[model samples]
Target: MQFDKPATTNPIDQLKVVGKPIHRLDGELKTTGRAMYAYEWHDKDVSYVYGYPIGAAIAKGKVKSIDASAAKKAPGVLTVVTTLDVGDLKKGKFNTAKLFGGSEIQHYHQAVAVVVAKTFEQARSAAALIKVDYEEQPGIFDLQAAMASAEKPDDSQEPDTAVGDFEAAFEAAPVTLSETYSTPDQSHSMMEPNASIAAWDGDALTVWTSSQMIDWWRTDLATTLGIDKEKIHLMSPFIGGGFGGKLFLRSDAVLAAFAAKAVGRPVKVALPRPFIANNTTHRPATIQRIRIGAERDGKITAIAHESWSGDLPGGGPETAVNQTRLLYAGANRMTAMRLATLDLPEGNAMRAPGEAPGLMALEIAIDEMAVKVGMDPIQFRIVNDTQVDPEKPERPFSHRDLIGCLERGSKAFGWDRRGAPGTRREGQWLVGMGVGAALRNNLVMPSGARVKLDKEGVVTVETDMTDIGTGSYTIIAQTAAEMLGVGIDKVAVQLGDSRFPVSAGSGGQFGANSATSGVYAACVKLREAVACKLGFDSEDVVFENGQVRSGNRSVPLAQAAADEGLVGEDTIKWGDLTKTHQQSTFGAHFVEVGVDVSTGETRIRRMLAVCAAGRILNPITARSQVIGAMTMGAGGALSEELAIDTRRGFFVNHDLAGYEVPVHADIPHQEVIFMDETDPMSSPMKAKGIGELGLCGVSAAIANAIYNATGIRVRHYPITLDKLIGELPDVA
Candidate 1:
C-alpha cells in the first residue's frame, strides 16, 4: 500500500485504541522474568558451550603471534577461534572496523579471539590463558591533534547547506555573537550488554541476539560470514535497552556463530562491560562553532554553524550542523561539517545522534546572543521561528508549532520567575531558569508488514520491527486493533524475526510512526480481504467488533476466514510529500537549576518539555521516550563523558562507575506535555516521531540555566563543576 497521498478519515482516526495510554503488552512477561534475553536462551536438549572473547591489548599494531596452547590445555576448553583461523574475514557492511582484528588492530579492546568451553566460567578463565604479542605503533588518538591534518571522510553521511552570504551578513550586523563549544564522546550504557546465542542445525545457523535491527543484522552477519543469507535466522524479541548501540551487528553475534561452528555445538557469548566502550560504537566527540547575527529588535539576520568531529578511517561525520540549517529564520545561513581521522572506536548513532549534541551548542549560542542583545531568550527564539526552511524558503513546514510549545512551556514552567544572573539567591544556592527551543526533523522510511486473521478471530501482525524498550509491541498492536476495529487483546504482535516482513527497524526516531503505519496499511488490506470473502463491497465494508458489515449484510470476521487464515502483506512506500514539505517536530525545554555558591555544584530543580510532534500513537510510550531522552540529556549536560586515554588510544572510562549517567537522584521533577495536533503529510497515522525530539535542545537549556545562575558561560560539554568553580563569586 503506497502512502503517496495524505491520509483521510481512516478507521485509525476513530482513536479507539492508538491514541490511548495503553500499558505495554510485553510488560507482564518482562516483569515476571519470563522474557528470554540473548544470553539466557538455553536449549536443554542440546549441550551448549560458552564463548569468551579476548580483546587486543594494543590500540593499533600488527599481530606478532598468538599463542593459544595454554588456553587449549585449560580445563574444559573446547576450541579457540582466532582471527588467524578466520583469515581476513569480510567486514560487515554496517561495521566500520573488522570485528576480529588481528594483524592490524584497529583500536584497543578490539576482539582478537574467542575461547569456547563447556561452561562460561571455564571459557572465561581459559580466555585469560591465551596470549598475544603485538607491536604498538603511533596512532592519532586526540581529535584536536588529528583535526589539524584532517581530510574529508569518504563516508560523509550528510552534505553541507548554505544560503545567502553568511560571513558578509554577520560582519555587517551590529549585534552578533560567535562561540565555540565542545562535546566529548558518550557511551550508550544500556542495561543489557551486546549478547548472542548461536546454534547450528546442519548448515543453517539460528542466532538469538539482543539487537535493534534484526533483518539488518541477519544480512550483515551472512555477508561477514560469507554464507548464504537464507541459511541464517536471527531473532531478538526482547531488549533491555539499546539507545542506538544495538543498531548494528556486534562482535558477540559473530563470535558466537564462529564458536558454535568450531565446537559443533550451540554457543552463547556476551561482551563484558569493559568491552562495550572500545569494542562497539559510540557518539563521536564534536567541536562546533556557532555564529549568530541578530538585529537590536531580536531578529536573526545571519546564522552559521561549523562542526568538526573525528572517527576511524572511512567513517562518517556526526552531521552536527543538520538542525542549524533549518531550525530558525536566517536570511544568510550556512552549515558545514568536517571529519577527521582518529584511531578510536567507531563513532555512530547514539540516541538523537546529530541534534542531541548539535542543539547543545547551537541553542546555547542563541542564549548568549539573546543576553548580548538584552532580550528574553524565549522571545528571541520565538522571533526567529521560521515557518519555511531557512535554507530553502520554497519549502514550507507541513506542521510547525514551535511558538505554541514555547508559549505553553513558559507558562507551565513559570518563566517570569527567572531573574538576572546571580540576582536570585536562596541562602547558599543561586537559582535561575533557562529555556531552549527543541527541533528535530521528522524522517520517514518505507516500512512493510504482514497481517494474518485466523479462524479464532485473532489478528496477528508480523514485522521485523524491534521494541528496544520503546513500547513498539504495544503500539503496533494498538494500530492493528484500531484499524481492524477489534479489541486490543485480540491483536497479537510478532516482531524481531528476520523471517517476518522487513520493517523500518527502530532508529533515528522513525521506527515508531513508520512501523506502525505499515501495520495499519496491512490491517486495512486484511479488512478488505475479509469483506471480499463475505461477498461484501470492500470499499463500503465496516469492520467493527470482530464483525464486518456491508449494506444490509453482516458476518463475523472469523467466519470469512474459517476455511483458511486470511493474510495480507504490503509495504508503505512513501511519496514525494516529504520532499515537498519541511516535516519537523518542535518542542520547548524549560529547566530550573540551582548552583551552590561555594562549591559550584549545579543541581536541577525542575524540568518541563512541551512537544508538538503530530498525533502520538501511544501517549504512555511517547512520554516514556521523552522522559528517557530528558534523563539522557540531563546526563549529557552535566555528567556523561567518555574520558579518552590518548596515550592508550581508548576510552579510559569504559565502565559505568567512571562514566556517570543520570540516576533517580540526579533527575528532578520532569513534566512532559504533548500538544493536540496531526500532520497529514507525515503518514496515515498522522504521527511524527517524538523519541529524539525530547532530547534536542535539552542540554542547552541546562547549560543556559547554569549560566543564568552563575553569570559564567561554559562552552565545553558535561559542564563540569571545575569549569564553573573558578569563575563563580567568591565565597564569604
Candidate 2:
C-alpha cells in the first residue's frame, strides 16, 4: 500500500486504541524477567561455549608478537581466535574502524582476539594469560587539537546551508552576540553491554544479539564473515537500551560467530564494561560557534552556526548545524560543519545526533542575544519563528506549534515569577527560570510488514521493528487492534526477526511512524482479503466486533480464516510530500534551577516540556520517552563526559563509576504535555517520533537557567562546578 497521498479517514481515526494511554504490552515479560536478552538466551539443544574478547593494548601500533600459548593451555580453553589466524577480514559497511585490529591498531581497546572456553569465567581467566607486544605510535584523540588540519568528511549526510549574506548582516547589526560552546564525548552506557550468541549449522549461521537494526546487522555480519546473506538468521527479541548505540553490528556478534565456527560449537560473547567505552561507538565531542545579530526590537536579522567535530578517517561529520538552517527566520543565515580526524572510538549517532549538541549552543546563544537586547527570551524566539523553512521559503511546514508550546509552557511554569539574576536568594540558593525552543525534523522512511489473521479471530502483526524500550510493541499492537476493531489484548506483535518483513528499524526518530504505517498498510490488505473471503465489496466492508459486515450481511472474521490463516503483506511507499513540505516537530522546554551561591552547584528544581509532534500514539510511553530523554539531556548538560586521555588515545573514564549519568536524585519533577494535533502527511497513524524530540533543546534550557541564576555564562558543556566556581560572585 503506497502512502503517496495524505491519509484520509480510516479505522484508526476512531481513536479507540491508537491514541490511548496504554501500558507497555511487554511490561510483564520485562518485569518478571521472562524476556530473554541476547546474553541471557539459553538453548538446551546447543552446548554453549563462552568467548571473552582481548583488546589491543596500544592505540596505534603494529603488533610485534602475541604469546597465546599460555591461554591455549589454560583450563577449559577450547580455542583462541586471533587477528593473525583470521587474516584480513572484510570490514562491515557501517563500521569505521576494524573490529579485530592487530597489525596496526586503529584505536585503543580494539578487539584483537577472542578466547573461547567451556565457561565464561574460564574464558575470561584464560584471556588474561595472552600477552601482546606492541609498538606505540602517536594518535590524534582530541577534537579541538585536530581541527587545525581538519578536512571535509567523506560520508557527511548533509553538507551545510547558507542564505543571503550572513557576514555583512552580522557586521552591520548594532546588537550582536558571538559565543562558542563545547559538548564533550558521551557514551551510550546502555544497561546491557554489547552481547551476542552465534550458532552455525553447516553453512547457515543464526545469531541472537542485542541490536537495534536486525537486518542491517544480518547483512553486515554476512559481509564481514564472507558468507551468503541468505544463510544468516538474526534475532533480537528484546533490548535493554540502544540510544543509537545498537544501530549497527558490533564486534561481539562477529567475533562470537567466527569463534563458534572455529570451535564447532555455539558460543556467546559479551564485551566487558572496560572495553565498551573505547571499543564501541560514542557521540563525538563538538566545538560550536554561534553568532546572532538582532535588532533593538529583538528580531533576528542574521544567524550563523559553525561546528567542528572529530571522527575516524572515512567517517562522517556530526552535522550539528542542521536545525540552525530551519529553526528561525533569519534573513541572512549560514551553517557549516568541519570534521577532524581522530582515533578516539569511532564517533557516530547517539540519540538526537545532529540537533542534540547543536541546540545546546544555538539555543543558549539565543538566550544570550535576548539578554543583550534586554528582551524576554521567549519573546525573542517568537519574533523569529518561521512558518516556512528559513533556507527554502518555498517550503512550508506541515505543522508548527512552537509558539503555542512556549505560551502554554510559560503559563504552566509561571514564567512571570522569574526575577533578575542574583536578586532572588533563598538561604545559599539562587533561583531562576529559563526556557528554550525545541525543534527536530519529522523524517519518513519506507517500511513493510505482514499481518496474519488466525482461525480463532486473533490478529498478529509481524515486522522487524524493535521496541528498544520505546513501546514499539504496544503501539504496533494498538494500531492493528484499532484497524481490526478488536481490543489490544487480541493483537499479538512479533518483532526483531530478520525472517519477518523488513521495517524502518528504529532510528532517526522515524521508526514509530514508519513502522506503524507499515503495519497499517498490511492491515489494509488484510481488510481487503477479509472482504473478498466474505463475498463482499472490499471498499465498503466494515470490521467491528471481530466480524466483517457489508450492507445487511455480516460474517465472523474467524470464518474467513477457518481453513487457513489469512496473510497480508505490503510496504508503505512514500512520495515527495516530505520534499514538497518542510515536515518537522516543535516543542518548548522550561526549566527552573537553583545554583549554590558559594559552591556553584546547579540543581534543577522543576522542568516541563510541551511538544507538538504530530500525534501521540501512546501517551504513557511517549511521556516516558520524553522524561527519559530529558534526564539524559540533563546529564549531557551537567555531568556526562567521556574523558579522553589524548596521550594514551583511550577514554580514561571507561567505567560507570567515572562516567556519570543522571540518577533519580539528579532530576526533579518533569512534566510533558503533547499538543492535541495530528498531521495526515506524517503517516496513517498520524504520529511522529518523540523519543529524540525530548532531548533536542533541554541542555540549552539548563544552561540558560544557569545564566539566569548566576549572571555568569559558561559556553562549555557539563557546566561543572570548576567552570562556574571562578566566575561566581565572592560571598563573605
Give per-model CA RMSD: 1.2, 1.2
Q: Candidate 2 lDDT, tens digit per residue, 1-732?
A: 777778889899998898999999999999999999999999778689999999998788778778899999999999999887787788888998888733778888888899999999999999999998888888888788887887755544666678999999999988999888899999999999999999989999999999898888988888889999999999998999999989988999989998999999999999998877888999999999999998899888999999999988888888789999989888999988889988788899999999999999899999998889998899989888889989889999888989999999999999999987667778888887888788888987788999999998999999999988999999999999988888888899999999999899988898899999999999999998888888999988888878888999988888998768899899998888888788899999999999998899999999999999998999999999999999999999999999888888999999999999999999999999999999988888888989898999999999999888888788899999998888777530
TM-score of each: 0.99, 0.98
Measured with C-alpha atoms, the lDDT of residue 43 in candidate 1 is: 64
Candidate 2: deviation at residue 379, Å? 0.7
Instruction: For candidate 1, write residues 1-732 as lDDT tens digits.
Output: 788788888888889898999999999999999988888887668788899999988888877889999999999999999877887778888888888734788888888899999989999999999999888998898988777776554544655777899999999998998889999999999999999999899999999999998888998999888899999999999998999999999999999999999988899899999899989999999999899998899899999998999888878888899889888898998888889988999999998888989999999999999988889999988899889988778999999999999999999888998988878899889898888888898987788999999998999999999999999999999999888878999999999999999999999899999999899888878888887788888899888888888888888888888867899888888888877888999999999999998898989999999999999888999999999999999999999999988898989889989999889999899999999999988999999999999999999999999888888888999998899999775531
TM-score of 1: 0.99
Candidate 2 Cα errors over 4 Å, as ranges: none
Cα error, residue 672 of model 2, in Å, equals 0.6
For candidate 1, the C-alpha RMSD (Å) to the true structure equals 1.2
**Candidate 2 global TM-score:** 0.98
Runs of candidate 1 exceeding 4 Å displacement: 153-156
